[model samples]
Target: MARIKPQALLQQSKKKKGPTRISVTTIILCNLVVVLIVFFLFSTYRHWSQRSRFQTDNQFSASEDGNAFMDAKKADVPGYAVLNTSKGFVTVELFKESSPEVVDEFIDLCQKGHFKGVLFNRVIKHYVIQAGTAQGLGATEDWTLRGKHYNQLDMSLNLKHEAFMLGTSKGKRNDKGFELFITTAPIPNLNEQLIVFGQVVKGEEVVQEIEEVDTDENYRPKSSIGIINVSLRQKI
Candidate 1:
């Protein structure tokens, strides 16, 4: 048997081993891909969970002790509402950026046919036009899609109550949601007191017509001026 040199054996071992297959860059890229996938899944899950929770039937009501459940969720996208009234068609663009939870509650009610056939009960000439009430007045018996009532925004956004600006009814200061109103003139005093959730993007004339209608002593329309239907669609 012939003795092999140590150097020769080392060279033969190196030849058998071959070259490195994976580089550091490849490992790093793979890790990055995995991280991105995980993040995407997490975000998707959170979105669906929020949607489900918002659509649930667990009505949030204030206790007799005065502890109310507050809804605080940021808006995800802008929503559009089309009000088909006996007068004319009015379009509104919801301010999801400023009032997300309010917009969500409004859209949910619209989807559930809560606004259909509801009377534009109150109309103040040169001021505002109010609606979304089952009972003509500021009654608490109306139930929204969210619950018997809807959540009030915390009024964090300093949005002005300008012409065409949409605001929830100030029934007891944040205890009303099924009722809403739109201003026909700039009312700066309403700032920080109401949630300006939307604005009229089109059909300002329609809003004016509604506001100009003849009303009784209680601001109710003398004739039947009601909403035929109210629908909401996501902004494309």
Candidate 2:
């Protein structure tokens, strides 16, 4: 039998040792990548959970139905509008400073009884109750106002959709529109979508009642809920 030389033994050892180092490094890198992936997943889940919690807490607070009255808050409110509906009265404090033209147009419409027979056609649970459109909830109306651009109507007001806030947005044409919506909860999702021209300074409970009313699958009230009329109060 031939005896193996020392150099050959050393070369064989080198091959085995070289592969071991490479394998060890690859395993370490793979494990590190897995750790990073898990950490990222955990962080994303935590962020989502926190946001959901915040949304729930804020919604609860907004729905508490706190003191609803035309008090000091309405002192410098510029104006107010009382909407007489089938359910009850909903008084809104107009945001004339932020949205002048839209506010004025709304006031004009209210005083002229434009919404006299319009129904509260749409009501989304925990969302908004929409009205003020001549063609009911779906069809687009040709309500021409002073300004044609969206900014003049305060469509860029970017007001957070809080409970009782009255807002309007365009239909398919996509500009400052006449259809108005009364929100029943704080909706952050609608932040930059609609123009909030006023907020309910009074009759919050009335809004709650309207929102709690039964509706069809299409969110239309099972029972007729019409806007008897809207009265504008320049001095709140």
Candidate 3:
């Protein structure tokens, strides 16, 4: 038998090591694949969970009993609008006919509890505290308000901007419902140009408190004016 040289023995060892290296690479690849799968599953599950929470049912019902008040035409006019803010309550009377689509969209959002926990995102001193726009990532989930179309009406109406007069939102027309502001001072420029649908009937003190909050250079409140709840009060 011929004795193997040290060099030959080393060469054999390298060949044996090749299979071990391949096995290690395969294990690493498998682990990476599993990690990717897990990440994808987690992301998909989270997306679906959020969607279910914000999903809205657009079904509107009218009373069958001979109560004409519940009819869609009558129901479109909200009896009263109230905003329970962290500072206090701000109430308004809805002007249904002046801006029917805008007012109805607002009422529907309130009924769905969409405004609860939202904040007044913008506040301008002696101007307004614009709330109803969703804060953070919550607003993107349900952007459609039952496919309502946006329309701009002529601002020739004889309405004055009062403390709580709810005006049309300041974005594109028909984008009125989710964004609302309560006037801190009378903005005459807005007269008739923006739909003045409602006026604050009560809680002027709360509105004053919100207007008095400390704000930053950009006029954003250092502390948020959070909406605790919003509901309708029976018309007197």
- Which wins on TM-score, candidate 2 or candidate 3? 3
lDDT of 3: 0.67
lDDT of candidates 1 onward, in order: 0.70, 0.70, 0.67
Candidates ranked by TM-score: 3, 1, 2
Q: Residues 1-236, candidate 2, lDDT per residue (tens digit)? A: 99999999999988774433457889999999999999999999999999999999888776653423434444434488888988888888889879877787776666566788788777665567888543423432211111122113343345455567888864442122367788776665555557778889889998888878787655668998878888877565
**Candidate 2 Cα deviation (angstroms), residue 155:** 25
Range of the 10 consecutive residues with the lowest summed lDDT in candidate 1: 142-151
RMSD list, candidates in order: 19.3, 22.0, 25.8
Model 2, backbone clash pairs (residues 3+ apart or across chains), number: 0
Model 3 lDDT per residue over 24-76, tens place: 88999999999999999999999998776645321222233445554766775
TM-score, prediction 2 = 0.53
Q: Model 3 off-target regions past 4 Å? A: 1-72, 134-160, 170-177, 191-193
- TM-scores for all candidates: the values are 0.54, 0.53, 0.54
